[model samples]
Target: MCELLGMSANVPTDICFSFTGLMQRGGRTGPHRDGWGIAFYEGKGVREFRDPDPSCDSEIARLVQNYPIKSRIVISHIRQANAGRVCLENTHPFMRELWGRYWTFAHNGQLPGIRSKTLEHYVPVGTTDSEHAFCWLLDQIRERFPKPPKRQTTLWRFIHQCCEQLRELGVYNMLLSDSRSLICYCSTKLYWVTRRAPFTTAKLKDADVTIDFRQETSLQDIVSVIATEPLTHDEEWQRIKTGELQVFKRGQPC
Candidate 1:
């Protein structure tokens, strides 16, 4: 199994606070320590960092923790390596180009026999079933709609349907995003919380730290965080039901 983290914000925001909690789970607070990766979407481009080492000990991970790379949408994962070898290419938060836009994907569940599904437009660079499923998903989307759909919901619904089909294979909790939208699907566990005006302090469940978001954010800021588990114990996190799909854009659900 693995852990997933995502963010969608109305304004460009850094994920240092949330990421600190998640990185602890990579080896200290949790058991997923095989590898980790993160993708930050800046406008149409993505700034990505990955390492085939425990995030708790990786120097690269520390750099990311210290650097405030702001983004409107982000996807990150810490892997335990159930299906693939512990290598750089086998890391989660895989990326690919589709419809002339870069899409990022991260999974927290196993999808056995996912490779048996044929892919047309996309191919996996890694051997993990997660990556194979991502390619297959993109393949299916490309087949159904050669170009981006006119109505955004049309594509979102199709993605949810595809996720349902994949869920038949095994647990399929996932986080996916283009630069504009963050798509989350829950199979067993997923939770989300949005912070807006009159923000309050939030303390990490994994670390001895607290952040008063009010001091760091403006009244107009709206930020949503999605994770396999709640990062902070203080905030009232909303759990996503099994077999349900949620889509977030500009920090709000759509």
Candidate 2:
């Protein structure tokens, strides 16, 4: 299986710290080394970075670690390549324009028989099952609402149903975002941790890295991080139950 990492914050924030821990695992500390990608949502615009090379040694990955690129929503992935060949197009955190906003998606598990399902409005440019599944999901969403829903609850329900239906297909753990919100679904493994007022130190488990949140943040900052595994050894990360979907908008959502 691959790995996922995402962030939703009340205020503009950078994911460099957490991303550093994940990069080391792309080929050094763990096995997910096939490819990697990340997307940052800055208002209505999106900044995406992808490379088929292992993130452990990618120069681009090194730059991202040093860059304090800030955004309200973000999604990232490190792939193990169970269902796709290693290529630039096969990388996760795929992007597509929908309802006038760029929606980004990243998947963490394999799906069998996904190739048999042909899609109409949305089609995959990459051979990866993850991209196919993302296109299929967008098609379902478009069918549910010709345009973006006017009500928040209606849209939430629609997104949940689409995820539920996809869950029936195979392992479908995913992270989706459109700058305003981050929708996460867990079919097998996922975990999350939130940092808020009275922030404390978090020590990375895969590297000798630690960040004292208090030193770099204000009381108004609230950042919620979701990942395939806990990034820190001391922080209590909440594990998402299988078949669960949660939306994080402005750092909080049920």
Candidate 3:
């Protein structure tokens, strides 16, 4: 299985603190050493960095750790390959254009017979069942709504239904976004934490590091982080229920 990390913020915020803890799990602190990738949304454009190497040892991962790329939405993954070879194409956080906007997806689990499900439009560029499931999901959305829907809740509910269908196939924990909304679904384990005004210091569980978010954020800022596991030892992380779907916009759950 892989690990997922996502962020939705009211204001553009860097995920360096949380990402630092997650990277440690790639090889140093955990066994997910197959590969890693991340996608950062800036307006209508998305910037992605991927490597077919353990995130803890990758120089690119170090650069991302050092650089503060502020974005309102971010999705990242660290893989422990189960269905695909350890290559760049098999890396998580796959990106594809949808409805005039880029949709980014990162999955943490597998579907053994997912490829048997026929797809209409989107196609996987890799062999991973994770990527195939993502393509099939987008195909379903495109089939249901040829154009973007007017009511956002309708789209959210439809996406949840699609996820529930996929969940029936196998473990389907995932994070998806279309540059505006962050969607998370949990089949087994997932957790989230939101930080806002009156922020306090947070200590990482994987690394001996602490950050005082008050010094880095404003009173009006709201930032929510979703991860496969709790990244911080000091902060209270809410566990998403099994088979539940969550939609977040501007750092608030919808």
Best by lDDT: 1
In the range 175-195, model 3's lDDT, one tens digit per residue, is 999998999999998999999
Clashing pairs in 3: none
Q: After superposition, how far is residue 166 of candidate 1 from its true place, in Å?
A: 0.3
Worst 10 residues of 3 by lDDT: 107-116
lDDT of each: 0.95, 0.89, 0.93
lDDT of 2 by residue, 4-122 (tens): 99999888899989999999889999998898999999899998898999999899999888999998898999988888789999998999888998989999877888877779798
Question: After TM-score superposition, what is the CA distance of residue 157 in candidate 2 from its true location, in Å?
Answer: 1.4
Displacement of the residue 251 alpha carbon in candidate 2, Å: 1.8
TM-score of every candidate relative to the true structure: 0.99, 0.97, 0.99
Ranking by lDDT: 1, 3, 2
Cα error, residue 32 of model 1, in Å, equals 1.1
Give the Cα error of residue 99 in candidate 3, in Å: 1.1
Pick by lDDT: 1 or 3, better one:
1
RMSD of each: 0.6, 1.0, 0.7
In model 2, the Cα lDDT at residue 252 comes to 65
